[model samples]
Target: MSSDLQGDGGPDRPHAQTEGPAPGAAPTPPARRRRNSYRSLTSRLLSADAWVDTALWRAGRTIGEGMRSYDRFLRRFEVRGFSRAAAELGSDGATFGLLGLLVLLTFAQPAFEATRNADWMTTEDFAVTFLDRFGKEVGRRGIVLNDTVPLEEIPDVLVKATLATEDRRFFEHFGIDIFGTSRAMVENLRARTVVQGGSSLTQQLAKNLFLSNERTLERKVKEAFLALWLEANLSKRQILKLYLDRAYMGGGVFGVTAASEFYFRKNVRELSLAESAMLAGLYKAPTKYAPHINLPAARARANEVLTNMVQSGFMTEGQVIGARRNPAIAVDRSQDQAPDFFLDWAFDEVKKLSRRNPALARDRIVTVRTTLDPALQRQAEQSVDSVLTEFGQARRTREAALVAMVPDGSVRAMVGGRDYGKSQFNRAVDALRQPGSSFKPFVYITAFLNGYSLASVVPDAPVSIGNWSPRNYSRGYAGPITLKEALTRSINTVPVRLSIAVGRPAIIATAYKMGITHELQNTVSLPLGASDVSVIDMTASYAAFANGGLKATPYAILEVRNSAGQILYDRSRNEPEPERILPADKVGELNDILINAVENGTGRRAMVDGVAVAGKTGTTSAYRDAWFVGYTGNFVSAVWFGNDDFSPTDRVTGGTLPALAWQKLMAYAHAGIELTPMPGVDPARLKPAQVARTGDGTPAATQPRILSTRTAEVLGRIGRSLDALGQTASAGEGVAQP
Candidate 1:
């Protein structure tokens, strides 16, 4: 190529060296020509280096000129121009930050959806105040205070203690404290467990208001977003107020005011520093630190709160020293051992009644006048405790339940277990146990409904149905015994025979109509009390006989009124009247038989002096359960003794501890109460040792054995027919229920 075309024609350029051939010359040997071409290329590259330097110098001059022009242009405004540019840049950055924040909020739609509940806008859905039948305040349930205490009204020490222990940086952050969270995370990582929570007070309020106690990532995300939403909407004061007002304090209490009143028996405004510290300590776990349950633990927790206040610079050690020296002591409630079990049941009833009435539900606060009798409740609790304390170890039983009600089905007292603190299982209302011979009344009532009188004869012999045979408790048959006598002895085979004779369905129908709510299975041993039933249900069923053959449905709440004195539910005004379930004569006959059972037979231990008692005893197979359900003219009560695991005791018959407990409870219940005659019961029969006499001036042996010879023959034929029918039934039915 020519130098002129290559633009390599400079006068100061060095001459190109040639090894063999020159430009445009004929090619020499191929290798010699190639070497010559490489040398020429090297000569041109060395020449281009100088040209490249000149070009770079020219470009540098051009850039210098442009920079000088820019400097001259900038010199017009001087320093002010730089400041304005920086301000504009900062403004742009702020706009981008706002947009980024909006984008982050967009990801919180799920949290917004989770926390949105219209009901939460208000303080509470409902608060319940419980009163006894006499309109005296025995105890309280639900949110006790209808109105939340203002933050200004709360003690300064309480607020300080709460902030110190719960969230020290409560006022320093917006919903989520990043610094606090990071510190907590590091600490948790070092410890390998979550010993400290990083949630702010606002976050805690959000969780309390809208979330459940769940430790899940999804729940945490929702809690965070809701906390942010709360911070955005509410001031710090409002958030703190809500946190204090909605947090759960123990003893079925919510909010500082209720907790103060519950533990110290005073208004929140009157709380001392020590009491305030105790209440503040319950924020982490209310049940764990409830003063009424465990005073020492509560005091220890309060001491921690006081120390936290000192460390947080809210108080000096001297200021908290008094609380440490003598911790707050709760009022002695020894006289008022509140029947918590009955109250719980009554609270549930209030909820149900409120749900049924939309207006009541909207009221959100009510005073329930329940059928509970405080004195009777105390007596019941004492009776159960005494029995379990005296005989529980010897009998190998750990639990006992007692339920007592008026003849009108008003539940006066209920003792769920020996100790309410150890367990909360309400055996009186929730547990179902086999009724044993106590269920025989339904079978005998069926016989009466079918035109068979108590004087009718029935052979109490060993009875067989398929592979199953029911024998008497003594394992010996009492041949040709009157129905009344059979029931008095609690003969199992006779009731089974009666059940088969009267049809098992009829017996079940009778039980249901009489107030047994449990679904009874139609089995061969059904009349022998194979079905499991609650003590409350059995008591209510027996109340029917006391209520003159009318179905006495069990009821706890007598009246419910709102805070504004408007009646929401009145049982007498709202509930339908009970219908007559059994004829008067049949009820009378059945009552006569049960009277004899309690007065002269197995249930004699349940007898109370100067009161007409009628009831039956029930002992389940292997002594797994023992029950005595008895009633005086004015009250009906049922007592049960058993183990929670369904383990058999050391042969505790119903006539033993259960009957004695029933007697104690009845004696207390019948005191100071006018005795009313039980429906179809002779008032004289209630007196001790006052029984009908037979010929020769002796007590009647088995109700005079009143069945005629012809009646006996008819009954014998009927018994045979029942045996055949029971065998057929057993083939179709399954084995008996335990």
Candidate 2:
């Protein structure tokens, strides 16, 4: 380095460096000078900070001025438009005011309050009629009611599922949710339709409680106001309870309890998760989502609700999936059988009871436990159906009715027509057609009461009363026939002679005593069923024989109960000491004869397997009506066949059609019951004429005869006419009138 320096003449150049500082030589400076230079540079940078702050301040001021100017311009424009809008709005203000007044007045009615309370009377409940619980009558319909339940009694699954399905934010939101409403509005606007509803449960309750189903802005506004008011005034539980109680489910169900019973045939508290989901889904569209209408669609909607429940944290995923796999539940529709007629009959009686005691006519649900055995009614219907069907096939007879009752006046079953749905007219209680030869039983009963015995011989030849000549159904008379044969064969002339001897008035009185309330003509032909009477009256009259001469007024309802489970009335026992109209011995004689009529008389076709049936057959003039009234030891039944329009039909007799119906009915009625033998008449009390001829050498007069005087006379006349034509009377006897 020293040699390089020597070569570069560094030592010698020291003097030159010192002289003027060589071209590349460094200059030496004082420390204070360096510090001063650094301070000056810092000062310049610090000064530049002021300019930056000033420029920013001026820019912000300019932006502020521009914003003020824009705001002033907007205010001026808005003021002008608002003033014109105010003028236009002022013109329509009075119209809106009047509309508001009208709306307020309309909604202010007391009926609105009553509707909100769900208070309205039904026509049948308010009617004035003394109807037997079993008797068919007018202005009667079944009961429908609104059932309320406690909040806790409502299933938790239903609540959670309903919220999940209908409105998930029900718990957190007020009566109206702005966010949900906004979303609904935007969705509606985008679709250009009203496909979604944003109503809360409160709003729904408001609509159901106080408004008709009218869609309008004013109605919506009122609904909203009411909903808000409800939200503030009532707790969430109360609102939900009201909704559940008052909401209308389809199929005549008006509340959750009723809906639960209607759909599941179970209590609301018994609903499972899947059932709860289905009921929840019904809230959106009850008719559409009803399980009865569309089970698959209802299940799909229910599954969606279950999924929503899981998503909304109301139910777990596992629970929801389990609910989805559950089977669909439904009520047993069979239980809702032909209750309309029974309920109609029951309500009519309830009205009468209520009329007797107006205090019982309160606005409460009443349960009427009736004497009607559904099974018996069904049997009666089937029996009539089978008879009518068979008769229609065999004899072209398409009309018939049947009434069955206990001898104690309890109506067991009734069939008013071939099809109750097609025609609800109850012919059993209303039709008053002639009873024909069935009336002869009452005549004979009168004769027996007047001391005529079963063996008493009566003239069966042609008989004349003034201008009227009575002939036997069989033209040729079996002269001097026993009274038993006269009734058994339903002979016309013999009954005429018996009626003449006993007096028609006595026959009429006997009919009245046996529960024949209808008026009977005091004519010679009345004993031959010339009087018109209802099937019910005739059946009841016949029942007196079965009940040992005690007359029971036909009644239907056994008891009536209110919604609160109070027994308003009950008919568990007989009303009082029954009205006794005939002596025991007389009734016994008639019953024996009637039983003989079924065993070997015109009503022989009415016999059933292992059953002892007593009955009489009747065929009206011109074959307008056919009737059979009968009874077992435990039950009595009546059947009638006729045209409703009162037109003539082919010669159809009670023995042919009505007796068959009675047989079919008794066959079913006594299906499992043991057959008990009817108590026969006491021989010790029998008179000489009342003794029947046995195979042993007894008197021929004592033998039972099946032909009446009129029928025997008519048969003899035909036989005589045929004899003139070279045909014997014996060959024509079998060709007597039915």
Candidate 3:
């Protein structure tokens, strides 16, 4: 305010104004006063200029310093934030959380858990009946059960090879190796794809069990989390055990035990280092690296695993070199061609059982011992091939289905088609077609059960219903014939008349009791197989007659075990209930009539050389379907031949292709089995025929009833002449008098 306390040089120099103030006016009244005024003005101007310049310079310097500090702080903060975020992303906590989420998600879905319930099976443990129905699907192969081996029992080679190929730091890592993960990340980034996984054996097991193989950040997070959780919950040895049991190997082999049997037909403990390396190589892609498909690639991968083992100090260099020089490991390809159909069926059963009891459906290995006789299965397949080939050569028919079963409802062999590999459509279980006259047995049996004996007479002449007249296959009736003869000949009119006599509902009920669960039409024509039924159902229903009067449901699996050799379910017959729907005597009678059918009826072609067989032939309208369902003393076989499109086949009768196929199949089935006689009705209980005579033993004016074959022959000649003349044969109008 005062310029250094008004020290402006302290007025030391002369005031240099030098202006002539008013000229000479008063020698300037007091030079001191003027000087003071001038000094005040100068001080005010200097103070104002100094204040403005100093304030501006200080404001500019402050702003520049603030901007520089802010820029430096922002760069440092950003760098630290990014590094923290990356570190957190790779932390154990984050990995564990991710894995926990994946486990929860996997358990949330039914399909993932459903695969666990699939029934497993070995080559034995099946009954002859089961073998007959599904044997063809099995062939002559055996399935080894998946069993856990102790650490000591596991081959050192396998242990070392897997460690070398899958995780070099398996022993050191807690669950995941940070270095391996970083390397994997770098490799993945460079390759622009997920071509590398640095997951340890534990991590891989975690991913397989809890996380999907999907490549995503969220999935990786989940995998990491699960890996940590698995490590915490399970010890290293336990994790390795799980890894060995759950890992996939080539040729449909799922675990180390399965792989050993699949590749070398030996136990897991018996594998050499080279063999272990070969099996370890299958982890990359089991089917792709299967010895059966690509031997060279498999061998190369095995050698690489061996080399890695040597480098990892698990194997000596000489051993690696020796393994590399060894010839390609030989594997039996025959074992690989297992019966897929049986496997599928067993899997279905396993699923059903598991669904019924969910405790057996999770985290357990299951082995199913089924009723599959490999010998019978092979014979069944060969029979199918032979029959199909015979028919194919004659008539380009490439499709056929056959089902063989024991009378106790055990399916032995089933061939859905010629080539199961080309197409997996199981025609035996899926295809539905008309049963044709093969269903007539039920109708006649219904009549027999309803008081009409086998000796009862039925007119096979032209018969008419309300605007619907049924004719015989031969177009001409055999005249008055015995019920036995009518059925043996498969006369349509006799069955139609018999169905009318014994209500249609009675036949339907009988058929249903025999395992014909398919919906049948409530019409008069149902006696001739107007309803659609699957081959399996038809064969099973007929098998009821073979097994006396008790009905047995067809089943394939006897027991199921998990991958850990734990029994998940057992379908054994401790005390199987009998579903009795028919009288034993009636069944026996029906059995007798059916036996006669094969012995001397339309199904005569189904007879084997030395076996007493009984069955029925069915020919539908327009030749749309043909079937032959027959049974030996111990087995029942059903053969169906037709076009898949439901189109008519040219002149393909049930007695033709289907009957021949049944014959060929039965020949193989009865090769070693002995034939037994069917039980028949007691003759003493049957009432003798009542013959009415007119004058001189001539026929009476009443109904000229033809009861026996002798009388039927006389009536048939007269009926043919009368039918030829276009005149209806009235009762008691025989040409020759008796």
Question: Candidates' TM-scores?
Answer: 0.65, 0.51, 0.51
- Reference-based lDDT, residue 479, model 2: 84
lDDT of each: 0.81, 0.71, 0.70
Model 2 C-alpha lDDT versus the unseen true structure: 0.71
- Residue 599: error of model 2 in Å? 1.5
Model 1 weakest 10-residue run by lDDT: 700-709
Using lDDT as the measure, which candidate wins? 1
Candidate 2 error regions (>4 Å) = 1-140, 143-336, 357-359, 362-364, 674-738
Model 1 lDDT per residue over 445-528, tens place: 899989789999988787898999988878788899999999999988888888778799988988988888889988888998
Who is ahead in lDDT, 2 or 3?
Answer: 2
1-738, model 2: which lDDT tens digit per residue? 566557554756575454555667666567867998999999998889988889899999998999999998877866457787896788699889989868765664433453343333232323122222332221223323323457787889988887776667776788876677788788999999986678877888888866666787667777776777678877887777777766666543556777787789888888998888888888877767778766788898888888889988987997677777885677645334453444444555666666565546664455554556556677677767766776664565677877788777777677777764345566887677888888888888888888898889988888899999988777788989998888888888888888788788888888887777888878767878888888888888887788777877777766555655455665644257678887778787777788788888888778764456788888888888888889877688889988888766677888887877777666655644433334454433222222222112232121122232235335644754665565444457666643
- Pick out the ten consecutive residues of candidate 3 with the lowest summed lDDT: 123-132
Q: Which of 1 and 3 is ahead in TM-score?
A: 1
Please list the residue runs of candidate 3 whose C-alpha ends up more than 4 Å from where it truly belongs after superposition.
1-337, 357-359, 362-364, 465-467, 561-575, 674-738
